[model samples]
Target: MTATPRPGRTIALVSEHASPLAVLGGVDAGGQNVHVAHLAAALADHGHHVTVYTRQDAPHLPPRVALRPGVDVRHVPAGPPRHIPKDQLLPHMEQFGHFLADEWRHRPPDIIHSHFWMSGIAALAAARELGLPLVHTYHALGTVKRRHQRQEDTSPPDRIALEKAVGHGCDRIIATCRDEVRELAAMGIAADRTTIVPCGVDTTVFTPHGPAAPRPPRRHRLLQIGRLVKRKGAALSITALTALPGTELLIAGGPPPHQLHQDPEVRRLRETARRTGVADRVRFTGGLPRESIPALLRSADVVLCPADYEPFGIVPLEAMGCGTPVVATATGGHLDTVADPATGRLFTPGDPAALARAVTALLADPARRAACGAAGRRRVLTRYGWDQVAAATWDVYHDVLALHPSHPSRGRSEVTPGPAR
Candidate 1:
């Protein structure tokens, strides 16, 4: 029997801090940026009209810019027209919501789905005015951040309480991983209120057949990409390198190369390399061009994502998509994405010895590493593509709309069943 096609609905994705239009690899730009960007495009590809409402962080940004066909990126003026850290963006959310309300007054959407917690707060402030059913996806929870970072956690004091309130306010919650669902349940949000939709990779961009980045011949190559935040475990990767001589590490994503020496974290990591006597073996390329990422991934002998705690990492999937074996910390989404012996290795988080051990084991056995890479590629192709992720997200929206009294699908005997995991 042929499966009936799912109908598309107008969607307003409120990602107040993480804009789909922002450049990737900055402190504020990472998975959420990629997530919103690709998800919007994929939804548009599925014939849905998408309007992404994000803060106008730059003075030159236009009010509404076309991202692609059927998609419009609407920049909402909240704080000053300049860069502001996401941690500090909360103060301007009410203003953000006011503008959102004004925009929706002119053009209301079928439903509003928010990306992160602050987006939920801003979305709720506006959604309440029109009594629109809102669906929320909290990319990371403060409780978890506090759990991992403790005193180092820079989230607002009321973040946990506000997040809980936002979760309750939303008609449905879309979690990015099973771990997130468990955390929400612990917060009194019922299991049924949340749906798990893993973040996806753009397979066309990250593939096994891409031109590999040129690197001087070395015994082995290890690459770590993403923001240079301390939690991302760049230091750990450097520390682990102390155990493997001649295996150089290439650190990507930070200020531009000319400005890299000025970056405190880069300075710290360099000092770490110097003190560990691996300074000559360590390299920093600063922020790479988007085109350079797949090549970099393809060039590495093994990719590393040793985060203190990841809430569904996009890097590992990207690495796996490129047919590179990964050595990720076994926490949060890594538990789901990397099949350990099947695709790559997962070691305990924050343990340099474990990371070294995993990398050593994978590197020492070429056959196992190649098998893992081949398996990883197959896993990404079958499961982690953007089409699968967007369809799951749309299913959650469809359910919300059908049950929502404001929607036309209400009173129907049955809406389509939820998407497969």
Candidate 2:
């Protein structure tokens, strides 16, 4: 007899702040948006029906939008239908949770997966009320942010406590890297409760074979592309530019060309370049067309990601996807992805000189850069593709579903949770 094919499960993804449809390169819109959108689409491609629930940021948005053949984007009416900074979104979690619980009560899904901490709060509540399986992925941990940003951290005061509750309450936690597992452990979560499913790159769009953007013939090019923010290390990269006289740094991402002059961070980075005496050598290419990213990545001799602290930074992976060598700080996910001296080089965070040294080394040796780029491409195809990520995530869903063979509404998960402080 032939073994019966397993039926696909319906899944709900809750992302309270990062709407899957938001344009990238915004102050708050970046990796999480990309992660949620791609994961939902990939799960749908895998024959599972998926629904992505996000805050209704615009009053004009329809209640439900068909994102793909098997995926739907549902707008949850929690707070005002306007842009609200994610750090200030915690007060709306109760309403968001109630809405989820009521919707699922009418039509339940097989799993509830949440992205970021605020979504975790809402998802945890809905899961508890409906006795549904919950999975959480904290794109960035509050403790780590506080440690790095200190007084600058804008998270709600109850963030850590609630994060703990969510970690303990959820059926499983999907961490993006090994460092996050350690961070979760420090919060009293056991390693068994968390699984690693990293943010993935779209390899088809980001391969090494694509045409590279034309560059300056005489000067070497360096690149750093993502949402232009202080913590992302644009300033550090600018500082490093002073040491490499023959190189030009391309700082891409921010408002469009006309609006770049008005952005505070852009102005700040410009001032940094000027003060470092590298203003002539630095260029700011405003938000680029998504289709042009692979070309931009290919044009760079070295991609710099010297973030103060990265929570599985996707830029390096994208750089790797384009067969570009990365020089990232050895912190957070960079430690996991950038295999030192192989795929790329790693330096200590916040050290501009060290960052410069790494970049200089990569620029000096063309063969080394090529070998690293090739290795980087191989690594991305093997480990960081969305299909692989989706399959790994599906395994987590299967394991959790197996743990709850009976209807979830009739019972809760039997796994013993670590104490939530």
Candidate 3:
């Protein structure tokens, strides 16, 4: 039902804060970084000339770097030429937009695919100026985050409104999960313009047959891998350790390993573990390298994803790809990927007792864990492969390009103000 993808088309990917080259599992660097990195590589493999435009986060780095054979990373100057928290980058979007507009004036891509809302703002400005088609993927929704985090949510006041505007204005919106489709509809994004494309895992890297990393000398190993933010529910994962006797928990993500002692959330989790009498059993490994993650996943008796909310968690898919059973919260993307009693166990979000019960159940049965792990691997191979995700995205690009063919007179020097929808 989709048109064949034309080769040699140039595509611009705009991600303002989450650079594809940034180290994964950092405070701002998590799923989006992995998603963009793999997606760009896969797209490049498919014969498209892909350029990823991200904010320049370091002073010493060059303006551009060849990320791969056909993919280029262009660092757009905005704000201070150094690292700044993603929440603080909203104020510099105007400068970011101007930079994008200037860049497009010289050499514009055939289509602009913006990731996250801030990137959408910049891309929208340039697209309007050049009459180029725009595709958007809001990796996470501000409205949902605000609802969940409430006072703790530090998102800019205009984020929700701006996200809604971008959702409605873009030519095509890629909803990374089925749950996001309903959320998009509620925010006034048209059903026809939105497409569901779940986040994928690298099957080649995450496999069951690989040599697993060495584990601590404990009866069982339970793993929790993600940022140490409160919303990620690392505390709950530590709490669950109290119920699973003879099992040691390995918390593998936060700031870099050397900087772990300074992270307040890590300190809080350590305190929580002490209070729960599991301090001796919980080990903090800090952040692991991407290359070491697959081995770590394979070493786990079970991988825990006890997040308060997740847009589309790549961790569950990665664990599944590694043939490791996941015990995840039953919310957001986890609902779509985690098959209850088949691939993994899911519990109500924020329930420490429920999380404990789920993990305890899995830890007690090796046969069930093996069965679930095998099923998960099969599910990932068939559905969540990066090749499949990139092919689907390519089809989307073809369709969007076909519908909105570029015109010779479209790129006239008209500096139109960005759309607020």
Q: What RMSD does model 2 have? A: 3.5
TM-score of each: 0.95, 0.95, 0.96
* lDDT of model 2 at position 2: 19
For residue 161, model 2's alpha carbon misses the true position, in angstroms, by 0.6
Top candidate when judged by TM-score against the true structure: 3
Q: lDDT at 273 for candidate 2? A: 86
lDDT of 1 at 197: 88
Q: Which stretches of candidate 1 lie over 4 Å from their true place?
A: 1-8, 406-421
Q: Write the per-residue lDDT of candidate 2 for residues 125-152, one digit (tens) a residue.
A: 7888777888889999999999998998
Q: Write down the lDDT of every candidate, Cα atoms only.
A: 0.87, 0.88, 0.88
Where does model 2 exceed 4 Å of error? 1-5, 405-421
Q: For model 3, what is the error of residue 16's alpha carbon versus the real structure, in angstroms, after optimal superposition?
A: 0.7
Model 3 per-residue lDDT tens digits across residues 1-421: 5456678889999999999998888889999999999999998888889999999999988999999999999999898999998888887787898898898889889889999999998888778767788889999999889989999988887788788777766778998988899898888776898988888999999999899989767479999898888899989988888888899989998888899899999999999999999999999888888999999999999999999999989999999999999999998999999999999999999998999898888988999999999999999999999989988888788777878746633422222233222
